[model samples]
Target: MLYSYAGHILVIDLTTGNIEKQELNEDYARQYVGGRGLGARYLYDLLKPGIDALSPDNILIMMTGPFTATGIYACQKYEWVTKSPLTNIYLCNNTGGSFGVRLKESGYDGIIIKGASNTPKYILIDGDNVDLQDASSVWGKKVSETQRAIYEMTKADTIVCTGSSADLPNPVKFAGVYDGHRCSGRGGLGAVFGSKNLKAIAVMKPNKKIEPKIYNPSGLKDELSELIKDIKKNEVTGEQLPKFGSIIWMDTTAQFGILPTRNYQDILTYEDIEGKIDTTGYGKKVVKSKELKAINCLDCPILSGHVVIPDHGEWAGKPTKGPEFETSWALGANLGIIDFGHIISANKECNEYGIDTISTGVAIGFAMECRQKGLINDDILEWGNSESVIKMIGKIANREGWLGDTLADGVRSASEKIGNGSNSFALHVKGLEVPAYDPRGVWGMALTYATSIRGACHLKSWTVAAENSKDYIPVSTEKKAKLVKDIQDLRSVMDSLIVCFFAGRAINKDWIVRLVNVVTDFDWTPEKLDEIGARIYDLERMISVREGITSKDDLLPHRIMEEPLNNGQWKGKKITKENMEIMLREYYKLRNWDENGIPKRSV
Candidate 1:
């Protein structure tokens, strides 16, 4: 009997409206673990290279880890894997909500969706009853509305639905969650769903709990208690997170010279400007004045997500989940907008429209830079204009005319289309825009952004914590490659286990091993899991390599490498070409790859 997993896979073809259930491959599970790792392996096995990412040929897999629905801290997360419609490469995005837990309880390990429907539809999984129903009734609605409608129609406990943005002629690169404020908000997966004519996926909680077998329930309980205790004890996860939320890093980033301000043309050097948007500044001006409260995911120990409500002004009395560090940086500092109220409103608008805040913010930043450089003559878009930022959110979601359509295509595609040296300023890696972390200030991120399979993703290897914390691993080229590789491998393990990275920060590898042992039949050690991580990373890289990504493509934008920070304590700091070459050579060597970053045949 399978332990800690449902041991079944569901397949739905939108073209024929057929459903198929298949047994999980134990060998794949053992090698790749689950979640991110399992998703990568399955994609590699199922797909060939060079298919149109928006075409029916492209596949999407929704996967959960062994720890999902097991009452473990941060196990409520699940991941979506697909060839990105934005990047045309492999992509994996995770979201936190009750959908994953309900999915597992419904007795399926994961679901693979393929083919495009002749018309718009939504998937309904009510215990054994699964069907593709017409979505025309709800297709054009906003995220919250679509979710509410789906819940009302299906009475499902959990739902993942696309926003109206997905139905646009040029769908924006993100989508929202209906179950909670969670979102699968990256790599334009929502646009892929739109391309496939899928509106939403609604899941009902299992009538009866189908608990995965556990070897030692009592021991597992004790381990869980210890983990919870450890989390509560950790200052960052327990105190700081619950108190300030993820935006706590705004102050740190500002100090470290990593905060991307004014489209990254300058770092946070001005005290007055920094003080306006920094954590304390925001707390006083926004949260305190508005009386917004903090909220956590279901059973989440660290309440990193907070509800934002403004007491006065345009967005007064409106509530939204967050403008996390990245969101705040992208829409706030990057745009030169310091009003916390405006930032909060923009965050809410982005969520409602089912847009990826990072991508949308970057797209806007790119547009502002382009306009500044006379590359485009967009009157509606200007740097530091919060009003314009808020308006563009709706325009982009609806694909309103040239500006909206162009922005919806993402920074890389948009820049390439409107070239007059725009690509030089377009901040992206492998077609995906970079997140808020400025790689120049945090040197390790250069390698992280360059080599990440999902293109300029921070979560793939979040080494910034090491750089900022007392880990002693300085953000330098000398040690960054090894540091990045190690973190990537470790994160691979965590992602497979489906533990939130925040929780992983508090728990150690040994604790994770114990959790696995108590829940699964396999006796996995730290060393074994580390090997699995390496395998997972290698497999994901291989998929990209197969898609024709070369060492040349494994690079950051010229702005990050060539242009030095003009201001701040990190003035003149940039990842020089030589520095990147050294780091890449070392990183490839450590990964057993050739000079061109192709994995050796033995690997």
Candidate 2:
């Protein structure tokens, strides 16, 4: 009997309308653990090399870890692994919601989706019964509407669906799949759903409420009690995040002089954007709605999710999910929009449209910069134009007009199409748009973005906090490679365990090993867990390598490498090509990869 897992994987081939259930491999489970690691293993075996990411040959794997639905705090995440339509490389996107828990209750550890459906369809999983049903009724609806329609029809506990953006004739490349307001919102996985003609996946709570068999329930409980104490003691996890939400980082990043502003043209401090878009300003302008209380993921202690109503603006009194730090920077500062209400409204639009806020904001910001440089002739796409930013969101979602179609493909493709030396400033690595952080301000982020397997992502290895610590200089490159590699490996373990990254603050290595031992009955040490993480990371790199990733592709955007910051304490600082190469070389050496960034060991 599998202890903490559902012990089965459901495979669906849309082309043939075939569904099969395979027993979980015990050896594989122990080696890869679960979530991103398990999903990546399945994807690497099932997917064909050199296939277009949106093609039927590209497989989509969603897996849950042993920690999922096992009464583990903040273990609400599940991984979505596949080739990215945006970056044309390995993509693993995870989300925190009730969906993973519900799916686990439905008696499956994961579901592997492949092949294109003949027509629009949605997957319905209710306990032991699973089927593909017609989705024509909800085909072109927005995310919330589709979710509502499906929920009413099937009475499922959770529904994850793409919005109308994914139903377009040509889907937006940065389209996202949403579970309620929370989303797997990067790497264009939703576009792959469009290609497969998949509308939504609805999972009903099992009639019997299936529970995983815990090996040492009492031991687990005692450890969790101690962990709860640690979580309460940690400042980041306890007070700041719960009270202010992630927007609390707004002031911190600004103070560090790493806050991205106006498409990376400059870095701004809280004083610069105070009372307009700063954290204090957000709190003053956007009040939590009386209708909804603060929200948190399943079994999470921290209530970081906020639902707010703007006090003033066209969107006044309208309740929406409050913009987090990344969303605020991307849609507010990066696009030069100061009004907190406008940022909230734009965030709402992105959620409804099922588009990535980071990529969407950066793409629009890229266009704004292009227009300023005469590459784009549009007058409306000017810096600080909130109205234009909101308008462009609609255009990008629907792939409407020339600018819409170009930008919908993402900044890299948009820059390529609007060529006139615009590619020099195109802010992407491996075709994925850079996130909110300015790499020039923190030198470690330069290497982080360049080496990330999924593309330019901050979550892969968030070096900002470590680099900002007193022991390390944020601007220096010394030992950054080791720092990044260690964090990346640690994150892999955390991600595979499928725990919330925020929860990781309290759940350190000793806690992780103890939890794994009690839950799965595995006698795992910190070193063994570390080895598994490295193995998983190496396996993902191998998958990307098979898809043509190499040292040349492990690169930062030209702007990040060449453009020096003009404002802030780190003024005149830039990550030059030589600096990047040195980091890459050291990183490659640490990973036991060749000079070309390929893994030395054969699969």
Candidate 3:
């Protein structure tokens, strides 16, 4: 059999103390690609609905995409997924760092971990050799501290760990880490690690090859060489994101009235900030991660890094990494705190703890709203009280109190506890908490958030780009469904190719195909690629539907429908139930899904 991948997939059953390696099957490789899409395929094949998320039966997967370790922009992320204790659906959390490259070098495209371990131990991979280390000393260490200690022991090796004190017995209090900087950052992947008595995964593979070309670019080598050259020659990455890192969009979202403020009850526009959120040469505020510093991936050169916030308060001098678009929207404006340091530090803590920062921020925001309304108490939560917030983080990782315990369930499940009116604003698509954007104003986002298999993830398909495209009006619904659907198909294709979501749109589909063609001579036509994307998307939907979701589960929160942007560029805009339903039906029809949003089997 021909091996297209330089690496293999390693499956370790901690419970059984068995380890095996499987070569990448070309059929599966071409179909699912890597990262989220591959994760779904793996889960679809292995997962049985309603299994306990924290059980030894749950298989935790650490996966990377095809472009990992190749020179591809924003292609640095790796996926960590399981039956999410948060969403209860297929959940894949990605972290961008050097881990993907390391994972590839360790001779695995992905790692599937099953069976629970009885002792606090870590899985260490130094090239092909694997060891189960005693992590008793490393247990309860923060991700940063653990990284330092473990790396010190391993002599500066790249490490991903979840021994942080944040891991509790339940999802409410679970956090894990990818490295010191990036985080899987969601869905209690860390807690699962803790439950398994698994402390960390240390990967120290330095020299490894992960790319195997299935299509050749030779045919288009001369023809499309100019485009590749153009991309290389330009400082597009440097010019757009330098200094601010992902936080560059902070003030911009505020200007557009999309910044979620006060728990989605209001949009904190540039007017509300009143120059407090001013854009500087660095960004609108203190840049936590700087794009000027590095556009690091395995081999890509689009410098993106945390802008190093000079900290204060409990997190004084704490250099937080990102409030990138997601963190910015969820933590910064969503909770009505313009304190950049606080925002950065919170995200930093989430990263260190190995929890999804978006959900943490949103969960806290919901808690704050509940507190203010007397639905809950300051004893439970206090707005802008960083101490309480920090405590809540601890409580969540520890599942300390009732509210914290409830919140560990995430916004969708947690909201159910509020009993009345709270469910209306629970703000989630598929149980994953919504990021900062309020879809009420951005019509395309309504669909994006609603249909996202992982609940409000913008990565699955970025229709907002088309809606905000220079070619179309931002708010119009006409042609939106077609544009969104097309993008979704294209996105699925790029995902299999394992490039960054940003790159999926930054470069054209034809260019990507050509790039792949150069590496492998496969005749990957755009139409065929789209079909592949559609099929994967359909399969993911099937996974969701099989797990018991229906058209009813595909609806947005009522607050987004009831609320309008009270000020700024977007005003008097609110998506009605009828309007949203129509758009959804249209979207389903375009995808060959039934009225209930189920994909036709023949499709």
Candidate 4:
């Protein structure tokens, strides 16, 4: 029987040493296109409702999409999905690296990994061949080091392996690790891998060149040409992003007086916004004035990377991926340290350590707030001390010392333990920490933060697109529900298409359909195709609802509600609880969700 381009999703049941490829029917692919959408569907199907998140029975899928490796926008992306050990809900982490491209070249769109291995093993895939190899020697290294050693062992194959051993004997044996540029860093997917006795998964390119599985449109070349031109003309994707990446937004976010300062105690912009911020937070500033080159992901041209900062702090002129606007805001203003160089240094170190810099920064910022309020000693933050901050990240990752052990629980759980009203300033929504944009100044973010499915994620649907930009009307609560819902569906479609968020202008629905139809032979409309996005988003929300998330869980920290911005452009602005309730109720109605933020069954 002929299958679509995706064909059978390779299923490897490591428990009984059984391996088989299961056909991916049209129904599965239609509702959940690929990557996150596909991963969500597969995991939700197999993972029993309310199962322990770290159980071997919990299915883990590493999936890609039809657009992967098609020379399209950001096609070099993949998703590692499972029930999150951290949040105990649908945890799908999307990473943009060469793994998916290699997998696609190996003639497969996705793989499902279930059951546990009896010993440390690595899943090696070269086209259709699969090998579960012994990984005893590779178990105890840091994440990046693990990647290098795995490559050497596998003869230069691209590897996605968990970093360091589970060190299963440690306090948080679940501190599982992995390597590659972008990571599924939020949820403990790595730990779930460790739980299964799986160390690494290397997707190798096949030696035998495989032909394309479906028909390619004769018009693909011309369509690509127009897309490139459209991308070149877009301002953020073209001009501003090229120079500053997301770093340019720092001063802008600061100007709004809502940049998550001092763990939400002060919405005030730091005095150091200009003095402490620099260009290195954007990409490889190693060459100095020799034309700074930004490190972009996959097929993106937005140049979200930054050059290195000159010697100022612990990391003096080290080349790195970034201290994007989110990292800078959480690590800098949120902590009251404005030294751009210092913040960049911390951000780089966190990435290198293979931890989520946003979470780490916010976690540390939470710790600092604890210190200021006398919950912990002041020695941890040590005024204007960048090295201490770096040291703190190391300790937290390793779960060392008292403060580090507490912080390893992350900001929310950690603050709750300290029990001194520290919970009020933790500034986290559902254990996962909040991102840069302060919801206080941008009232729309209040709903965005409170209702985001991924627990305070900005990317899920960055309403700031409508709030901050001149093209959008700010502070009008009327159309926000429709606005965020549309953008979210757009984001979902992009995730499935595996395209960058910047490609809406260039890669329109027709182009997307062409990319999909040509790749898989399914002639889907832009509207119908976009509906798949809505379905994926709804499914994700449904997973949360099943995991016990509801309207009561939808909340901004009490500090954001009661506290006011003491300084900067929009001083004294605050989000009132009454207005917060009004905003979310509207959003729920728009999303076809009940007042309690649960998806309405009638829809």
RMSD of each: 2.2, 1.5, 3.2, 3.1
> Tens digits of per-residue lDDT for model 4 on 472-590?
54544656666777777777777776876545545656777877766666677878876777788888888778888888988888877778777666667778788777778877876
Model 3 agreement with the true structure over 1-603: per-residue lDDT tens digits: 222344478889898788888876666776676776777788788878878777888878878776665544556567776776666666666666777777775678888888888877888887767777888888877777788888877753667787454445453433555665666666667777877888888887555544444343345346345654544554445454544455556655666567767788767766666555434422544543444243244445555554456364455565455456677556666776666666666766666666667887888888888788778766736655666666776666556678877887787777787876788778777777777666766688888778876667777766654566687666666776777778777776666556665444346787777665555445577877777788878887887787788888887877777667675577778888877777888898999999988898642
Misplaced by over 4 Å in model 4 are 1-4, 165-179, 214-216, 268-271, 278-303, 306-318, 469-473, 502-514, 517-522
Can you write out model 1's per-residue Cα lDDT over 511-582, one digit (the tens) per residue?
889899998877988899888888999998888888998799989999999999898777788898999999
RMSD of 2: 1.5
**How high is the lDDT of residue 72 in model 3?**
49
Inter-residue clash pairs, candidate 2:
none
Candidate of highest lDDT? 2
Model 3: worst 10 consecutive residues (lDDT sum)? 288-297
Question: Higher lDDT: candidate 3 or 4?
Answer: 4
2 or 4, greater by lDDT: 2
The alpha-carbon deviation from the true structure for residue 327 of candidate 3, after best TM-score superposition, in angstroms, is 1.6
Candidate 1: list runs displaced more than 4 Å. 174-179, 270-275, 285-295, 310-315, 468-475, 601-603
Distance from true location, Cα of 156 in model 1, Å: 0.9
Go through the candidates in order and give each one's C-alpha lDDT.
0.82, 0.87, 0.69, 0.70
Which consecutive 10 residues in model 1 have the weakest lDDT in total?
286-295
* Model 3 regions more than 4 Å off: 1-4, 163-166, 173-176, 206-236, 278-299, 318-322, 379-388
